[model samples]
Target: MGRGRGRDYTGRTMPSPSSAIRPKRGKKGSETPIVTPVSARKRVAPSRQVVRGDRGVKVTRAVTIRRSADELYAFWRQIENLPRIVKHPLTIERVSDIASHWAASAPVGDRRVEWDAVIINDEPGKLIAWRSREGAEIPNAGTVRFAPAPGDEGTEVTVTLEYNPPAGKLGAWFAKLSGQEPAQQVTEALRRFKALMEAGEIPTTEGQPSGRPQNTKAKRS
Candidate 1:
């Protein structure tokens, strides 16, 4: 064999390999796989968004009412008018142009919960957003949006609320079981608001007899 050449098993002359470095290969019929170390690998980000509270619950409800956005906005802008649309009694005492004090009966008991809120964003006839002040009994934040409905029908109102339940997840579960969860409350409130705006009154079964009324008037001949 020459200095730069070698003879293969078939007795054919082949050039010698270069001096470049190369990865070592395993034996015939066996292969080695490259693996990234844990510290060097790129981690995938979490898919879900991180909400405000550690145990926060968000509820959203929307309704279309046969009323103009301006009219609906006017009614909702005044903090005192909220009681008219809320089934569970609410009292809102205005402290300023953008702040108010709120009190409402607790879902699970006769006791009342109170919170102070200040409007964070407000656009006439379009949007209103607020957040409870620090030390509030129920820390919460919410937004109400009013937009013109499709086909010029009326206004579309959407309400979104985020709050940390009093006792965390357990309290939320109890509230749901009692039909007083934020979702249920928001749904009912929106329904009542729609009724009031479209029909001028909210329908209720209060003070109604269980059975059908008798024919108090005389029957026709």
Candidate 2:
């Protein structure tokens, strides 16, 4: 006769070990959350604060010149005329009606940095704005506005410039040390521009005598 089914002491068929029902593996959604001990948690390093002046530095200057708004606007609208009015050793070459390439001598070296810029806004006899294009050595932007001065005092020209120097704050510091700070440069440029517009020339004291002992003696007649 064939082997009969195995029975336990209670006379019930006993389930074989291999045939016993087991818990089925459930999907990932049914997993329980993991909890790590406080002592075993990782410590994340804190982040550093960003430098404030890294973005750029801004300088604004205003002047009143005894010239009509249209005349000043026309002169300034021509980008090629910039070097004629400013004291800085700057050169600009127009690439198109609204774009130009600019180069200027660095304050601490014989090196010259250049960039291309495009006009972003223009309003005849009112305002003009421009910004440097991508990959510029020193990114910069500027705006010039012309408005009527009080009591027929001619036009008020205001210029605002924001730039990120080549080395950021360090470069700005060097510029200040070399007497080429943007603020001072802008102020002097406007002064020169005013003189040129009103007097038709830039007055200067070149070759003037100084209070040095060697130069105190006059030439014998």
Q: Assess each prediction's global lDDT (C-alpha) against the native.
A: 0.62, 0.64
Residue pairs clashing, model 1 = none
TM-score of each: 0.66, 0.66
lDDT of 1 by residue, 69-126 (tens): 9999988889789998777667999999999999876555456778898876778998
Off by over 4 Å in 1: 1-52, 107-110, 168-180, 211-221
Error of 1 at 214 (Å): 18
Q: Candidate 2 overall Cα lDDT vs. reference?
A: 0.64
CA deviation > 4 Å runs, candidate 2 = 1-54, 107-109, 168-180, 209-221
Candidate 2's TM-score reads: 0.66
Q: After superposition, how far is residue 200 of candidate 1 from its true place, in Å?
A: 0.6
